[model samples]
Target: MDLNPKLPTLPAFYQQRIEALLARGSRRLLGLVGAPGAGKSTLAQVLASQWPGQIQVVPMDGFHLANVELDRLGRRQRKGAPDTFDAFGFVALLKRLRTQAVDDVVYAPSYERSLEEGIAGAIAIEANTPLLVVEGNYLLLNDSPWNQVQALLDETWFVDVPQDLRVGRLTQRHQQFGRSAQDAADWVQHTDEPNARRIEAAKAKADVMFRWDS
Candidate 1:
């Protein structure tokens, strides 16, 4: 299936830019960072799909602390906040992915929204994969472990979209995942909006600022 047949194709310039990185023949990590509903995951998937086996997506959501752990730490209410993730663990994974031996296959965790948990070893980065597209809200964050991520990425793009559109997307996503309409709206206003603000502050650090609506 075509991942982005209806959506506009990635610009020729961006495609060529990514191709140049692959041409270097060294494993490279490209990050797509943005607010919760700004389309980073979709963009990463579309780009990776275009390259088939040569590219793969490794999402940072996979580092989200389990609900049980979050509750224990009194952060269950702010599950998507930067502090709710295992930041150090994510940094470690990025380092491994960057320096893995040519023949080594590295496994990474993936987040399951329905279950609200992280499943270990759900993604495999094969030796032949030249590009790994990492998407997350904190890739550009200036905090400790998160700040460490920027150095590992060869290039990081900040995905941008209108705030109203992002809030609408977040509401629908929450409703689809079993929240009531009111609850979804409340969550977006109280939870996601705050996180979005934090993410927006780091946009300046991106190598490229991308407006998806274009």
Candidate 2:
């Protein structure tokens, strides 16, 4: 994750202190959500960096439909859309993680950008994990399985930045990952922007919405 982002420090950002988030006798799931380039992952990782053992991040991007599946459905170009994800699978995984056994170790998937695919069991959530920071694009989405995500999370944060900044970062990200400048710009305009607007519309559903420090 990039190092520029900061942890959400406002008192209202939490129902209690950060330490309280890591319950001693219970497990807590916190959702950090936003559009593609809105810094939700960065924020979650930063928070984890602040408290090592007590926090772990499990990204929802791990549910991306395989390239083969995307092509079969003609959704390769619309990869980040909600329907392109295994929403039911993700919800099932969260349900298992929420009620994880005392000695059971649960594994979750993570998206590998270099390969542009979801890698299975890339993240291990131990039974002792106190808080899980689940970051994703559609955690607050009102759709069926996606809506189930909010009910499972104890708290949720929506991160954002100005469109120009977000667009610039997204373009650079695409370029860094091998897309040409023109291709990156076109993707941001055609794909990312539409998703961003949809996510922004759900801002009201988050527990808190804060600008990602630029």
Candidate 3:
């Protein structure tokens, strides 16, 4: 795992708290979600590595609409918008992963970064496997789809970072993924920043706040 990014005090403590929660839940599921560049994925990975119990992760990114689908809908430019994901499909998968009682392998969806789309049957969430952690953006929005999804999460934590830091990181991340520097900056300043603001407003809906003081 890359530790290039140091762990801030609040996020580290949040990770410990998640591990303790997993220990107590034993067979129950837990969810960690936040906006883009909010560090939810990193937190999930850290917690999973420390959890002593059997752990499995089902990321909400797994439900992202395929690139082809986006193109067909004329929404390729607005890829990460909440409307772009297959909310119903994600809800179905979450329901199955949360309540099904079979012993066979439970196939969970997974998102492919290179392909920039979601792939079904890419991950298996082994039936009855405990300690499921789901992470993603827009999991706590009070609106229709997000509100519906929140009901499935046993516990939810929102990762909060300074606005400046988040925008800087997001711009860099976009450039790393092949976006032009100018385009990346514009995306971060416009689309991404607005989304971050919406998510920040939803922080109050989270059970806990995972923030970095520094």
Candidate 4:
């Protein structure tokens, strides 16, 4: 893996690669997989911005089970874990995106971090979108429905960042979302770190891997 500095050249470099995929004239799904706070969303946004109408971002966070459902399943504390999401539903959506003719608009769910819930049909993938950037933590996980994800993507890239830096970003994110300092630290120690380990284990599955420093 190469250390990819968060510079203008990096996005430009990737834009060229994405364009090559689009040149094939088929709808393609590109995955950006990484642990929490690893900047996958930022990278996806940059790519989408580079190719206005040609690329659309459909994040995996959109499939998160509602808080009510999580509480009922007793999985609220492990909200970001694999089991907490509608894995099959996510897979179904991807299948449709991959197989259906891009003649009609497709609606996809979107997650609202402020509400910690998913809003249905929040993102619209327009007809003939050449590239779909799917950002998620579990995209490379070799488990059940998640394993189905990699096969659907034309390319998958894993974002690598130093553990300390990722943890710091996560800490700040938790605080920004209303967690007390101590509570945020505890959650990171008990929840996010374990998920991070699981995400790291799948790094070998990525077609390409790159490190980013924010």
Which candidate wins on lDDT? 1
- Winner by lDDT between candidate 2 and candidate 1: 1
Candidate 3 lDDT by residue in tens digits, 43-130:
6776666554467777888887888888999977777878888887777877777776766677877877666767788877776566
Worst 10 residues of 3 by lDDT: 1-10
In angstroms, give how far residue 69 of model 1 lies from its true place: 0.5
**TM-score, every prediction:** 0.95, 0.92, 0.87, 0.94
Candidate achieving higher TM-score, 2 or 4: 4
- For model 1, which pairs clash? none
Task: Quickly count the clashes in candidate 2.
Answer: 0
Clashing pairs in model 4? Answer: none
Candidate 4 TM-score over all chains jointly: 0.94
Q: Give a tens-digit lDDT track for model 2, residues 72-150.
A: 9999998899999999999999899899999999989999999999999899999898889999999999888788899
Best by TM-score: 1
* Candidate order (lDDT): 1, 4, 2, 3
Query: Candidate 4 regions off by >4 Å?
Result: 1-7, 11-13
**In candidate 3, residue 196 scores what lDDT?**
72
Give the distance in Å from residue 118's predicted Cα in candidate 3 to where it truly belongs. 1.8
Model 1 quality (TM-score): 0.95
